[model samples]
Target: MTMKRYPIAIALAVAGSFAGCWTGGVIQLFSCDDPCYGLDPYECDDPCATCEGECLPPPLLGYDDPILLWTGEAAEEAAVPECPPEAPGLVFDGYGGFEADHVCPECRCTEPSCELPGGLTGSASAACDGTTPTSFDAPAGWSGACTAPAAVGSGELGSLLIQAPTVSGCAPANDAGAAPPELPAPWTVRARGCSGEAGVHTCREPGKMCVAAPVPRPTGFAMCVRYLRPGAPECPAEYPELREIYREFDDTRSCTPCGCGPLEGSACTALVSAYEDEGCSALLGAETVTLAGPKCVAGPELRIESMEARWIKDEPGTCAATGGVAVGEATPKGATFFCCQSDEVIAVP
Candidate 1:
């Protein structure tokens, strides 16, 4: 009976070994190797362990203090050092330096120049004092020199004593100095219109008008007249006659004289005849005259003399008479005749 039991035991062991092999094969076929198994277990690299939260350190600290190393309330507190408080009347001097009295000098931060005080010198000292002092020798204890206690009854002497430099050979000579040599008078070149003659004449100062008046026989004559500036008082004596005509846009516009012309009515006609004798015939003729008001009635007879050697039918009259007409019918007479019709000659009829 013992022999039989031993054989059964061996068979049972064999069957158990086969069952273990089958179980191991089935597990290997269904399960896969973990991709993140041997790698650093920081963030999720394994698809299967993504939702399990098995990763040791999270990718982001998530609201944790950046400067702190530990997580979950174990981080050391980080306190910034406090800066020094600013003092009154003190400011930064822009070079990492500070000054209590921040008022900069005229040349600010630069060494002061050796300029003489204002009331002590005139413009001559400007060129001499435009540099800094290379060597300065002050009296001993000059820092406290003016701050010393005064004598009991002595009046206050001024704080500092300033002395001008002693200059030699700087005296100006009285007789040696002579008035500036007189300058030659300035003259302007002008052309004589009648004979086409050119000559130079003395010119006036600037802003003066060079008026060239018409000479008696087509010659030229020039005179300088001071130009009237704006807002100047009327000077009729200075400009007795119109020396020049200017088209200036100012109050001087009213000062210009009226031009000679054949104006309206009998009064204007008579004025034009007296003032402008040369233009009388054209002005009073029927072709030009159109007397609207009062109808210009003829006046006293006027005698005229012809300057031309020959005369035409409708030639204009000049000199002492105005508007002459021819008497006889259409025939060229050797001599010219005067036409009479009150004062004005109507035509050669």
Candidate 2:
């Protein structure tokens, strides 16, 4: 009685059985980065200026006018890098990565180092508590419009062709009778671009991209001006709340002879080229910054701008954007991320 050969169903049963035995992950969700993996895996949380989980007002830019933005003759008409290439060169999904997977939020132990059969070494990674928790593959089986957290800011996504913001007093008039008044070397990003709930839109071409909201007149910025003039009524910097995210490419991160890749940087420009009632703004990791007002002035428009941040081991939750601005602290109430801090590089002017 028996050569009972049932085919498709038998094959399906065997395949399903083995599928369970085969253990491998198609995606990874990791956080808690090591400098060895790359620079701290989070955008610099400036602007928010939080501490102890409480929100503090953002710092003001320190300069008064464009005239002070440079030194010698150069500073007088301080030039920027030829307004950068129009096409944001190439577009790269500048998402930072997880260092390893065997992650333990308790011990902060990440995935273990990996070596393939021959020699291709690999590592495992996973998500951490405080970070935004991006998955290698967008979370599986997500439902509803609200299922996924939205990007921080608004403004169209992908290859943004933004015009340089125009600063009237910042520029000198054209040679007698030529043009009315020319704009400055390069335009800065807009608060509109960098100021919302959705994250941001960045250039695919990776380099070092950073913009001073309302164009910082100098370093240690204390103000973002609408139009710095001799005697005209003043307008505070468009949006003192700003963000400049710089990232590098794959091969670029291979530098520095370390096991980890090169710490690449990226910059996206949303140059505003309009005048009269048109201004721009962007937000960086400086979670808290001074508001645009009578007393608000930036220290310097130029800064070394580093994105790496160091939060106390115990205060992971404090760094999040939920509790207002936390600068070197651990709590907050009616606002965004509170108590974030970073060191300033230098003043451009």
Candidate 3:
């Protein structure tokens, strides 16, 4: 005969009324199609198994390490390296396009020149201080030779006045004809930097991170290091490394303005003689004096007929040269910091 089976709850309730408390080994309400059915939930390989606790999120892709930067520079004539190709996942992370239009020209000076003392006069005043002076002057083209002029009127030969010499021409020779030297080539040099991809395995090695540059290249280049991020603070928390790289320059380079100083070391002295005759053959009195004098000397009371003068000592002076020093300077435009995992430092170009 066939026996009918009921649900576990109904069968358990009927069995409980007829018998005392039942201790059961196992019970099944229905059969499951799953191969894992009735097994420990932890041992189940089922895709629909209910998990017991909280789930976790996945980690980010790529290396999580900070990126370090490098810089380089080149002259107008030399070749500067381009970003290396051997380092895969490398990027043209930063650029330092360069320019230098400032220049300092050679300093120069012209020879110093001076004029001779020319004005000579006689004064009727006994003090010889050029008061009430009269022309005892030599001829316009006189070259310090002795000459006799018309006899002085009574009392007109009491004193003589001589004028000092002056400076005539002096200056910087460079300013004579040329405009300033042509400014240095604009944007003459250039610079660029590179860094590896974050967490990139290939970028982890030194020198391997960069390689020989390609052709059609610039004049000069260098390998350098910099902070990966631009505009970072003076010392960034992540990158405390310090370095200097230039994108441009601040150039005020120039020669000092040309100039000349006061005259020095010039001197002249002359001898003046008074004569009783027009030919200046007989002298009444004579005095030796310098350009610093309006010197007066006691003259014989006799009527003065003529006068003559001759230079005793003559020496030209010089002017001190001033200015002409090279001034101003050229400096890197901005700063970019660099950080390293160790104490390794990259040389600047």
User: Which one wins on TM-score?
Assistant: 3
Model 3 RMSD in Å is 19.2
**Residue-level error in angstroms, candidate 3, position 188:** 7.8
TM-score of each: 0.10, 0.12, 0.40
lDDT at residue 102 of model 1 (Cα atoms): 17
Candidate 2, residues 1-349, lDDT tens digits: the string is: 0011232334332221121111143221112221112223244322212121111122234322111111111212223211212112222111112121111111111122111111000112111221332121112331111121222222212111111111111111112223222222121211111111111112122321123322222232222222222232322233332222113212111111112211122111111111111121122212211111111112212111111111111111111111111112111111211111221322231
What's the count of clashing pairs in each model shown? Answer: 0, 135, 11
State the local distance difference test value for candidate 1.
Answer: 0.18
The segments of candidate 1 whose C-alpha lies over 4 angstroms from its true place after superposition are 1-24, 29-108, 120-349
Error of 1 at 75 (Å): 25
- Window of ten residues with lowest summed lDDT in model 3: 51-60
Write model 1 residue lDDT over 1-349, tens digit each, in one string.
0001122123332221221112322311111243333335432122222111010111121111001010111111232111112111111110101111211111111111111111111111223232331111223322211111111111211111122211122122221234322221111111111111111111222222112222221112212122324332232332222222211111111111111222112211111011012322322212111112112212222111110011112112111211112112221112211111111111110
Query: What CA RMSD would you report for each candidate?
Result: 54.7, 46.5, 19.2
Candidate 3 structure, TM-score to reference: 0.40
lDDT of 3 by residue, 1-349 (tens): 0112234466443222222222253232322234234565434333322222111111122212232233334354345444444223344333344443344554545555434445456666555654566665556755545556545566546655555444455566666345445555444334454433221211222222222222222223222234445574354333344444455556666656655677577665666666677777887677666646445554433345566666666554666665556556556666554433232433221
Candidate 2: stretches off by over 4 Å: 1-72, 75-81, 84-349
